[model samples]
Target: MSAAVPPVRKERNNMRARAALMSPALLIIGGFLVAPLFVVLVYSFLTPGTYGGVIWEWTTDAYVQFLFEKDIFDETLIFSTAYLQIYSRSFVQAAASTAICFLIGFPTAYFIATRPAAQRNMWVLLVTVPYWINLLIRTIAMLFLVRDNGPLNHLLLSWGIIDEPIHIAYTNFGVGIGLVYSYLPFMVLPIYATIERFDFRLVEAAFDLYADRWTVLWKIILPLCAPGVIAGSLLVFIPSLGAFIAPDLLGGGKNLMIGNLIAMQFQASRNWPFGAAAAMILMTIVLVTLIFYARRQGRSTVRLH
Candidate 1:
């Protein structure tokens, strides 16, 4: 029928218009993200070339190398635990940094969220000011401040806190401090966003019901801020796990994380396959974490509803 034909034709035109609008974004994702990930996945299965390239030959040696190293002369697989130790260390540092960020960021975000709207923007700008400078520059600045004979040590020495300059710059302590400083804004902004939308009347109600400050915060404020906290933790944890610059500069290259390992594989070791495998493993872990987090959040939402 002619009437049906017009409606069907209009529907096709609408579909075509939508497809046209989405095509650029779809192409970019496919070309950049999906293609590179596919390349890495394929590289993980291939053999490493003798001279710093892939051989295109299928092999499981990369994954095997993660846990064991082949004996140079015996041609036997020797169980090695060094990489495992590195991974464990990476996890510990990431977790500790996340905890520190949360401890510091929660109060800072709360303070910001409690400020009047006119003043809030300035406070947020201060939080984000460090981001304007290059990360490497900011990290180097930290090194300057914390290094032995640096300003912090000089100040401590002037104040007679200790007889000699303390070695805080090139240690795990320095790395932790750098990580917390670098990622603090990420932790603060998310929690601040969540708290800004929170209803203050609920706080007043809790207080009116004879709830103390601690009780209101523990029960009402934190629970309402849960989404932001989770988001910020993920943002901080994932990157901190793969942190390279802070550890390299602050940890003095003595402390190596998974990111450093990956970089070493590609650059120093000239082992593309192993690097690809490590990258894949890292991606898989992050993916699993995100999925678990998303499911937990969904369940919590359902319960809240």
Candidate 2:
């Protein structure tokens, strides 16, 4: 018979086995995620080359240039608000999209969650049906729908809603609509998952105690499903903040978000260091937001317990 291994040896062997199993994932994260981020961080601190790429010399010009513009004649740094406006626009758009998604998605998720178990799947399937189509195709379809001579305008005209077609396509309004359409599913799914697991007994008890619909919703339902709501908000808000497609196509190059600004720096402007700096700043903001949300969530959970 084989001899039994010592406890210490067995523990070491188990750790080795675990590490062996994790090696592939570790390598993938290191190679793909971490390495790329490191490269971008390094590039952010470098000087932009005359042509396109970054120079070997390290400098903070890229970061400084974000808030200040250098004059061509005297080369004095002048405070600029153009980039700040773009960032503000992106944040406003993202926040608006998240709020709209929550308003629409909450009811939709509640409807789906309250449905018979057999029917719930069909509702979810319908919700996700749009995703099967390519995003570009869907965006283009939205553009066509919102165009001056499109079916939406035709329908509104027929209903005598307006004297003329409303201009939606190639505008910020169209971009907002596109963002809500794109990320609504993200909000719905998380909320549905949370509400599906909720106990109806508590709701019945609240009703029995003479609690009103709004009271039950605010006190019980919303508090219980806050996790999913927060998750969906993050899912929608983060992507919407960095959204390229909606602003690019719907806004028609007229209204530029932060994503478009970063792309312009890299592609049209040929300012690699500036683009890298923008990306790093965006990443930092997202990280800080995530940390803030995480801590708040932890505190809520502690209070609940």
Candidate 3:
């Protein structure tokens, strides 16, 4: 009270207080996220132990093995496209799941968002009810429903839809269905949030200007909800790309994805370094894709503005 503090000193003290507040969060992120990522990077560059896990020696053999395999007799590396196919399959399945989620989710979200505010929570609860059940349990339930001689097939056969039961379980179709069912809630929630906050006045204005339903949807609704669509797509796509259980159970090991490949390295092949390298590759691919998408979205936003 005797001496007034300088403004700069006061600001510096405030900054220090803010930094102290943030320290816990920063420490948690560094310890959990950054530490694990750094460990993976280091392991990716290390040599694989004969039994399992990594050796201390640095080597690029893990990265090299991603696209090539050593011939047993000649001990020479030859280009192999098997891993490429697995990556491609993962991408296709992920894309298909995302597309299906979007198609089903958009209408569902729109319908929910249009509901009376008093009843909106109930609709959201219904959408999210599946989350209360474990994903593995849900997938197994799907297996029971789609398997040959299961209730669904038996019902269809009884209805005389076809002479024989269609093989839906343990196939790509089953995996796709499981993925869509698992991630549909993720796709719905974001889009619903966006739509619920949307200015219905603009829709009315479009209608006042004599815009048809299709035109308004294409020119206004879709554009306005684009952020939610992108968010939902990323939410659905990323997890679908790394999907393990659905593919493992539904694909029956015949249709292997990148997740399966990673599991095989760590579990079956006992090559931790290769597995880490594969994980790093998948992370890099996801990062690049996100960066490209972000840039494109930025440009689109600028154009709209």
For residue 15, model 1's alpha carbon misses the true position, in angstroms, by 2.7
In model 2, how many backbone clashes occur?
0
Off by over 4 Å in 2: 1-3
TM-score, one value per model? 0.94, 0.96, 0.96
Give per-residue CA lDDT, model 2, range 78-191, as digits (tens): 999878888889999999999999999999999999999999999999999999998878998999899899999999999999989999999889999999999999999999
Stronger candidate by lDDT (2 vs 3): 2
> lDDT of candidate 3?
0.93
- Candidate 1 per-residue lDDT, tens place, 1-305, comes to 55767887889999999999999999999999999999999999899877788997999999999889888788799999888888888889999999999999999999999999999999999999999999999999999999997999999999999889999898988998888988889999999999999999999999999999999999999988899999999999999999999999999988788999899888878999999999999889889989999999989878767
**Candidate 3 structure, TM-score to reference:** 0.96
lDDT of 3 by residue, 1-305 (tens): 51598888889999999999999999999999899999999999999888998889999998998899888689799999888899998999999999999999999999999999999999999998989999999998898889998999999999999889999899999889989999999999999999999999999999999999999999999988998999999999999999999999888878988998999999889999898999999999999999998998898899889
What is the descending lDDT order?
Answer: 2, 3, 1
lDDT of each: 0.92, 0.94, 0.93
Worst 10 residues of 1 by lDDT: 1-10
Q: Kindly indicate the candidate among 1 and 3 with the higher lDDT.
A: 3
Q: Please report how far candidate 1 places residue 40 from its true position, in Å.
A: 0.8
